[model samples]
Target: MNLHTWVAARGGIAHREDAREWGYSPSRVRAAIRAGEVQRIRAKWIATSEAPPELRAAAAASGRLTCVSLARRRRWWIPEGASSTVHLQVGGNAHRHSSQAVLHWSDPLVDLGPRSLTTSIEDALAHLARCFRFEEAMMIWESAITRESLDIESLRSVQWRDESSRALARSVRGRSDSGLETVFVVRLRGFGVPIRQQVRLAGHDVDAVIGSHLVIQIDGFAHHSTAADRGRDVAHDAELRMRGYTVLRFTYAQIMHDWDGVERTVSSAVARGLHLPPTERRR
Candidate 1:
């Protein structure tokens, strides 16, 4: 296959510099783009018509599938917006690419070993951790599990000792409180409240959402996550309130220790918002 085909097969170039190494004059690259033989996905790389197909093969073979595409492919993670960049799990031996597909670096030990890269449902969830902030990542995690994208083997396929990996694993366990929330689940349970875990409502979801009371939201501490997610959260809550729902948000810290307090507040707000009498709410 030609260089363009090869790059396309590899899911486009990681960046523009890689294109130069392929020996295409700048003008030629632009001309190819105009002719529709190639396309510039990101500033860095030119994608040949075949790039997407190549990316799929490489992702399966590279053994480290990125969350953005994997999530879409495996139905693992879902987000409100389309991911602009592609995420890949690459090892030391993997050569650099000349495409906009952003490859994530990792040191997998054996082909199927802890250090070896892998392609599976879990990798998609793991990729979300690296690709987005913790809060957003957890949302993907919750969505995957709630949608059943995560599997028992997929969980084991993860290398937990690593911080990012571990955080993701923990997050999965955290949001999936269906009789399995603690180590993470405990905090939610301690409220002496009955939580409807992984429930969908009015086209939005709540992790351990309380019915007939209040809606509780859990947030993680991903860096640079607040400002990015704030407006979206407000809008989401506004819609929920419009639907006759009262929402209460809790962060990781609140869930960790003061969980009871958070629950109490939720319970109170839910009761008050619904205008239910005290005895009626405890049920």
Candidate 2:
């Protein structure tokens, strides 16, 4: 591949070694930079002018994007209120830069080979497991599985150094359709709430069922924007409530932007005994 194509394919930035591996000679690489075809991120990294800002920053920092930084780019669920610092992975023997980025100085479980701008999904998950809290890591991992970005079975076979990472791999399930649902499940779990994801009820697949009667539906913008979709969701929720089940619906905006409000709403329902099964409510 040509230098421009190779750099663009790797998300806009690449290491000199990766560029060389792509059949671009050192002189050609230098010429590209001098001719404004590419911008040098550091002594060893270069980016096309059209490359993404984050990838260029990662290259400038002398690291490949990984952990939460990579996960955010991949649309995986990240922790609420997490820092927006670029997370990068560098080789164990590589010289570290002093950029204001989070760096993981470890050997990746799976090498990127010629792909150096970002870590592979497997390596990102491994780093995520080590760096983030259990709930956050599990949410991201579950989101990855939900999107089929990585196969769960293949991930299962990979060894984990951190106990939390191992737990995350074991806990990931493919039923949750969105990162919102993943966060919701993990958050509810902390409250000792018994919840089942993607529960089939009344001919519709609800996002989650708590206790035995409370149903939760998570709507992302991509799925529930149209008037007909909103109308159908309202009808379904009404039907569920009419069937003696309490229903709670949250939207992408509410979950990601107003999580405190979301938590309060759910917590109030639980406090009012709305989440309990009929038998449990009586007790």
Candidate 3:
């Protein structure tokens, strides 16, 4: 195939022969950059695909497109973006790119498990945690799991420097839930609080179990609050308690905004109830 065909199909080309095969000399490649037929991918590369409008925006605006946006483009999973960070694959030794972007050059691309760009699943989920809010990360992480984004190889391929990050990546792939449930689970995980997602207990499917001690209920406050709702919740809590489960209730607002407090409460309760030494906790 011609150089342009090859580049467009490939998205990135750095070699000189590939440029020459496009019926253009090296000077012509430089001239085209000056003429604007193609945009240089940084100082040393080119996007042969003509950079789709969004990709161009992602490339130029942030120099890295990560988390939900990358997932959306690559894996087709849409996620909320509350000032989420975009990530690029600059090697650990690469100089920091200046673009108001929250760059993660240290975390090399491993294998997003056959994702849109073939980045590693650990890499993808790590990017999610680094760039987006806990809520957004949770949603995408859970969605990715439900959709099989977290293959064993991809999770194993995660690259991180800190022990916490490495640990989080190891376990992130197995948790999956609805969009809101995802938010709850992610925040819980972020704080290093143990949680079991989508567990069946007390004739109700609890959203999460914190260290096998407490059940976190992500109740929709909008629909709840009626007398019947309170009655149901109380009954559920009693049933769960009878079966050795502590019920920690959180509304949507509590889950989204003050998850730290929620985590503190749950983690403390878990530590006390499960007899886990405080330091043995993973967070």
Candidate 4:
């Protein structure tokens, strides 16, 4: 591939050495730079104009993207109302380069070369454990586990540097089908009721089942948007109800924007023994 295509293919930025390794000579790189096909950052990095702003910012700051910034790039589920601050990992002795960026000074979980513009998944999760609250961190961790097909046992084996990280490694079951489900499970853990996720009932997997009968279905922003999808969900709910399941359906807005109301509704259901089996409830 040509220089511009190659650079753009690599997320619109690349190390000069990587370009050379890809068979572009120094003169050719210089020519590309002069022709405005690529721009050099510091002396070692070159970027096309279409490079993501967060990556370009990291290159400019001589740091690697980490924490929520990298999580967002990797499409991990970030909690609603989480900070949008650009998070970067820099050397401990590095001076403040940008007031807008939140700098992480911890040593990386893995060694990254100077040319690397982003932290490894391990390092990003380690940083996230420290940067976000426990529930928020768990959301991203569970999303990463599901998206990456990460082995939970292997994650537990890593020598995580913080108690939060270790706790998360222990707590994460990698069972959440989506970040929304993770949020629901983590937040409801305090209720002391047994909750099973992705339970197969009525030939469909419900989001969660509390006790033996109460079923929880969480709808993401795009979930059930289509009429057909909504119809299928309605039919499934009806089938579940006919089978003696108490179905509690929640939307993204109800779960994220108005969690208090959601919590109240759930707590009310549990308080009235709605989560119990019919025979147990009668007792």
Candidate 5:
């Protein structure tokens, strides 16, 4: 294979040993770097200029992508407030230098050898469980399953290394459409409010329903962006209101950046008896 194909096949980066295994001489690799066809990551790794930033970072760290970095690359929903650190998984015995990146030293379930720039989906989820808080970890886990990046059956059989990891595994329901929805669910769980997720009401599937008469909508950018979609959503909210249900809508920004405001709004609605069933409201 040519340099472009070789680099592309290996996630836009390759090690000197990989090129050597493919019969590329050291001089040829050096020539490619000089000719601007590829850039040297360090003494041993080389990458095409078109390689993604995460891959380049992994190459610089002499590590493979894992945890949140891998999750973001695979388009899984990353929870709000998740650290921006570049997460990498190195060997348990590997000597690592100090850097701004977060390094994990656990053995992988499926080894990607030393030069691979990305982690397997299973390994990513495992690392995510160990790295993040329970709610944030479950959000990512469910989102991965929802996106079909990892299969539910495979998740069931994977061996978890700790109680927290096992608990995260058991909590995977694969239902939340976005990280915002995951936050919505977890935040409401503490209120002792009986919530029905993905419930059909007034010809629309809402994000959640609290108690009996409160319909909550979470507007992620993808699902509710167009003008006509917004109009339709407003109409649905009106219809639900006409049906005697109190409707509350929260955007991705509101839930992520101004959570105190969001929680206060919900709490006030519940305090006003808006979330209760008609019989409870009357009583």
Candidate 6:
């Protein structure tokens, strides 16, 4: 491929050495720069005008994107109202960076190669634990687990540097189908009721099961937007109800924005023994 196409294929930015290996000589690279096809970044990286701003900023600052910035790029679910600031991981000795960007100075959890413009997923999760609250960080981590197919046991074995990272590694079950599910599970941990996630019941995989008979289904917009999808969900809820399961469905807004109401409804259901089987409730 030609220089511009190659650069664009690599997300509109690439290392000079990678370009050379791809058969572009130094003179050719200089010609491309002179012709305004690509802009040189700190003598090692080059970017087209269409490059992502966060990536270009990372290259300019000689840092790798990490924390929520990288999580956003990877399409990981982040908490609402999380900071939009560009987060970069720079070497402890490096000094130059934009004041508006948040710079992480700690050592990376994994080594980044020369051509890498972003931190590894492990490093991103580590930084996230430090940058956000526990619940928010868990949301991102569980999203990563689902999106990246991360092995939970392997994650727990890593030598995470921070107490937050260690706690996250130990606590993450990796069973959440979405970040919202993770939030629901984490927030209800104190109920002292057994909670199982991704449980198969009535020939369908429900979101979570509280105690034994309480089936909680969380609907995210991406999955429940279409009329057909909503119809299918309603049918499933009817089937689950017919099978003696106490189904509680919550929307994305109710879970994220109206948690108090959601909690109260759930607490009432549990207190009334709706989560118990008929025999158990009668006893």
Residue-by-residue lDDT tens digits, candidate 5, 57-105:
7777767889999988888888756787889887754336635788887
Which portions of model 4 miss their true places by more than 4 Å? 92-95
| Clash counts for all predictions | 19, 0, 6, 0, 0, 0
RMSD of each predicted structure: 11.2, 3.8, 8.9, 2.0, 3.2, 1.7
Could you tell me the lDDT of residue 244 within candidate 5?
Answer: 86
lDDT of model 6, residue 162: 88
Q: Itemize residue pairs with steric clashes in candidate 6.
A: none
lDDT of 2 at 5: 78
Query: Worst lDDT window (10 residues) for model 6?
Result: 92-101
Of 1 and 5, the candidate ahead on lDDT is 5
Ranking by lDDT: 6, 4, 5, 2, 3, 1
Clashes of 5: 0
Specify the poorest-scoring 10-residue window by lDDT in model 3: 111-120
lDDT of 2 by residue, 1-283 (tens): 5678777887677788777876898999999888888888768888888888778776666568899888889888776687898888887544465567878887777787634778878888888888887877787788777664677788888887778778888888767777678878877777887889898888889999988888988887566367987788889889888888999888878887888999999888888788876557745
* lDDT for predicted candidate 2 compared with the true structure: 0.80
Off by over 4 Å in 5: 1-11, 15-36, 39-44, 92-95, 221-224, 271-273, 276-280
Model 6: how far residue 163 lies from native, Å: 0.4
- TM-score for each model: 0.45, 0.78, 0.49, 0.92, 0.81, 0.94
Q: Give me the candidate number with maximum lDDT.
A: 6
Expressed as tens digits, the lDDT of each residue in 37-113 for candidate 3 is 56675454556555554444344433345555566656534543344344454343344544444555644455332
Candidate 2, residue 11: Cα displacement in angstroms equals 4.2
Off by over 4 Å in 2: 1-11, 14-25, 41-44, 190-193, 219-224, 250-283
Give the CA lDDT, 0 to 100, for residue 211 in model 1: 46
- In angstroms, how far off is 176's CA in candidate 5? 0.8
Give the range where candidate 5 is weakest over 10 consecutive residues by summed lDDT. 91-100
Could you arrange the candidates by TM-score from highest to lowest?
A: 6, 4, 5, 2, 3, 1
TM-score of 3: 0.49
Per-model lDDT: 0.57, 0.80, 0.59, 0.89, 0.82, 0.90
